[model samples]
Target chain A: MLDVKAEAAEHSGAGAPGEEAPPLVVEGLGHAFGERQALRNVSFRLNRGDRTMLLGLNGAGKTTLFSLITRLYNHRSGSIRIFGFEIKDKPSEALARLGVVFQLATLDLELSVAQNLLYHAALHGLPRREAAVRLKREIERVGLTDRLREHARTLSGGQRRRVEIARALVHQPKLLLLDEPTVGLDVASRQFLLDHVRMLCNEGGIAALWATHLIDEVDSGARVIVLHHGQILAEGPVPEVIRRANASSMREAFDKLTGERSE
Target chain B: MRPIHYARCLRGIIWREALRFINQRGRFLAALVRPLVWLLIFATGFRFVLGVSIIPPYQTYIPYQVYIAPGLIGMILMFQGMQSSLSMVWDRETGSMRTLLVSPLPRWYLLTSKLIAAVIVSVLQAYVFLFIAYFWGVHPPRLGYLTVLPALILAGMMLSGLGLFLSSVIRQLENFAGVMNFVIFPMFFASSALYPLWTVKQANLKLYYICMANPFTHAVELIRFALYEKFNLEAFAVVGGSLVIFMTLAILGYDPGRGLIARRAGTE
Candidate 1:
């Protein structure tokens, strides 16, 4: 086993009493694929128990940033700390507290929904009894209790998304990262996933960073970080970013921030 | 992660692989068909023409079927290795590999677990081939069946490791079929899988050296000796060394820093 105590000390000194660290803190993060830069100087912080929308168009580096945060790709110039644990220096410790729902469908189409969740639970090192309990709870949250025995391929697009979210939550991660969670979902399914995540923030008290291209998915009160062309263009609450850009709507604001002159 | 967590993760991956294999009835059948065809058709045709010498593992001249049975076993495993690697490409294209990568488990554990799973399937296929070959009159000495288990496992590991390395290098699933044709046939035909290395030396010295140098040749030799309840130290060293080397390359190929999978994220 890795020396957890040494890793904790190496990344961040002991915290003061009653001072809880933010869920995520990233700074000066940059990544390039050969000569083409995918992300440059991206920085952000997510408060505990808050939902943040990562708004960007396709090819805007949302997936790249998520890949770095999830440790799927290492950034060349940047730092990502999850709950005060550096991603590069202490990946296991940092990743243990994180849950992710990727943009692509990751479920085993051949396996039952319950089986898929149980497998994921085992991957997280949850024992059988504990995994079963968590699995049932999360499945209920996603409203797929009856479909548990069905193959994932038999489910609708939204149902599969819910199952994925449930699978991500079964391990009780402190932070959830969803990359374009609603890309292929119908209107109702998209709303269902968003509402469920909101409930998780409010009730379960889990912090989340939801990535999406559609601007309407960004609730007014939610913290918004706009990424365009591999760089952060604007970050703050929705109203503030819009007012700063002198745009009336979030769409217009995004256009202006990305330098897309309105015709 | 604790040792227990690592064990749990490995178990999950292996179980999932087992589940996938069980569901793919066509793949299992295809795995058996290729080796069986070679054992029945090719070996039968060559049985009259080729005469195996009194190799250390063999006390007398052996029939071509008996000679090539172990080679066919090697063929089965080589195909299995490539088959598993092909699935790796499919998993990447389908995004299941990403789910696995994001896990808190070390990348080495995740990848090794995958390789072990492929080894398990290949080993199972080898036994099935052995069972069929037994009834087909290619029986080794009485103890050969029992003795071949370790040989199959060792050979399976080496071949699966090679497959994992190939999966890490081959970028596209469509391209893998072509690569597999180039790899599986060459590794199977260039080695002692069909004829003795001495026979190749008799016919062509250069082809003999290439056969002797091929790791699949060593794998077949390892199994060939083990099936006769004998041992071949040279074959053991070659297969073992190749396992370590290929496994290392595969593990490095999966590292997020410089591996092929890292480039996949940007392209996607």
Candidate 2:
């Protein structure tokens, strides 16, 4: 295999002029536990105002990569710069600038919708008055105003998932890292979430990395990174990657790249 | 995330515990029976075989029931602390604990908050046990004994710390029950809670040293001395040392990268 970690300079295309540094610049990332290697010298840079989609199969190390980015786990040999600060040297600062919604919903189902969001906002240290204003705006954006007074346990899975995403954005992070954001969502809710995420990337100028196994979630204009069996199989503009793929749908392209075939 | 914001998360965790217990009063009532059985039936029956004498803070003769109060209270704290933490394993099994752990806040603070809430419940249950002992006619100096508060707090902190450590280490909820056999009973039985170190010395010289070595014994002795309105510096030091050591272990147990909670859960 080519040395992906050593090619950082070649791949580090600075964002367009007037655009800020990439929200995340990861290079030579590697980790292992005892004898089992979890990640191997992975390198990728994600810039602000860029809407990048990450497609990977199960066991593709997507969650491990996200966990390391969040510093839920530390990297053994790598450098991760989030918002211009090394993650280890300044974890709170780096994490504060990024909003993350993991595959599992972090909403407290026992608490009222408002209570859950308020609690999370307080965790991020948003002042009460400030959080209230942001909470109102984000809740409405997710169409959860009517459900604020009810317990999250009562909301449907889609509604609960949306509320969780809104909770992550209450602090106005510069980057949004969503892991399988639409998992278990009905078709309508999935579309609703995708539309809002795209809007956030374009209108708010927020950089985002949406990790999913679903190919249809990718937007035509976005950059794409395809991971398979713990390695990056492809990375480039969506159209160009597919042009090389020579497949009709993005799924076919993903399958062709990963060498999976229909039964 | 801001570090001080952790206090709010702690309050939220305590609130969850309070809500669950209030909704299920039967659990507290049910737990009360075990200690009551030990105190009224077992202690009374064993009193005849065991000789009693004057220890410090005792004006004259003391009954076996009064002697074992501090030990029983220590037992309450340890078990309740383990009870709350063991339930965390249950929460993880059912997938609720994941919701709490994945929040932006640090994981250690979340476990600490849960421990504090468990301590409150344990201390409250202990107070109830004291009141029932009063009705059973095993009274000590009521006002002087209020020192039990600080003593209970110290013991509660230690037990909570112990429980937090276990939550991270145990592989499965069922395996945690085994922890009780190895840890809980030995610590309680070998402590000075049931008898003074002097009494243990008369019976078994080695046993006296073991009781002196048990930190729980010091917690019970601290409460015992305080009940008579006397303070033992050595006992106080032991309690303090145990709290610090246990809390340090708990902090290490919560390190996400190496924590046993995930390791045992088979999630990694």
True contacts kept of each: 0.60, 0.20
The TM-score each candidate achieves on chain A is 0.91, 0.89
Please provide, for model 2 over A96-211, each residue's C-alpha lDDT reduced to its tens digit, 9 standing for 90 to 100: 68788877766766677887777667666566678788988999999989988898889988898789788888888878889888988899999998888888877777788999
**The 10-residue segment with the lowest total lDDT in model 1 chain B:** B85-94
- Residue-level lDDT tens digits of model 1 in B32-75: 99889988898888878887778768888778888888999998
Q: Each candidate's TM vs. the true structure? A: 0.93, 0.82
Provide per-model DockQ scores: 0.54, 0.23
Instruction: Identify the candidate with maximal lDDT.
Output: 1
Kindly give the stretch of ten consecutive residues in candidate 1 chain A with the minimal lDDT sum: A10-19
The lDDT of model 1 is 0.84
* Model 2 DockQ, alpha carbons vs. true complex: 0.23
Q: Model 1: clashing residue pairs? A: none
What's model 1's lDDT at B252? 84
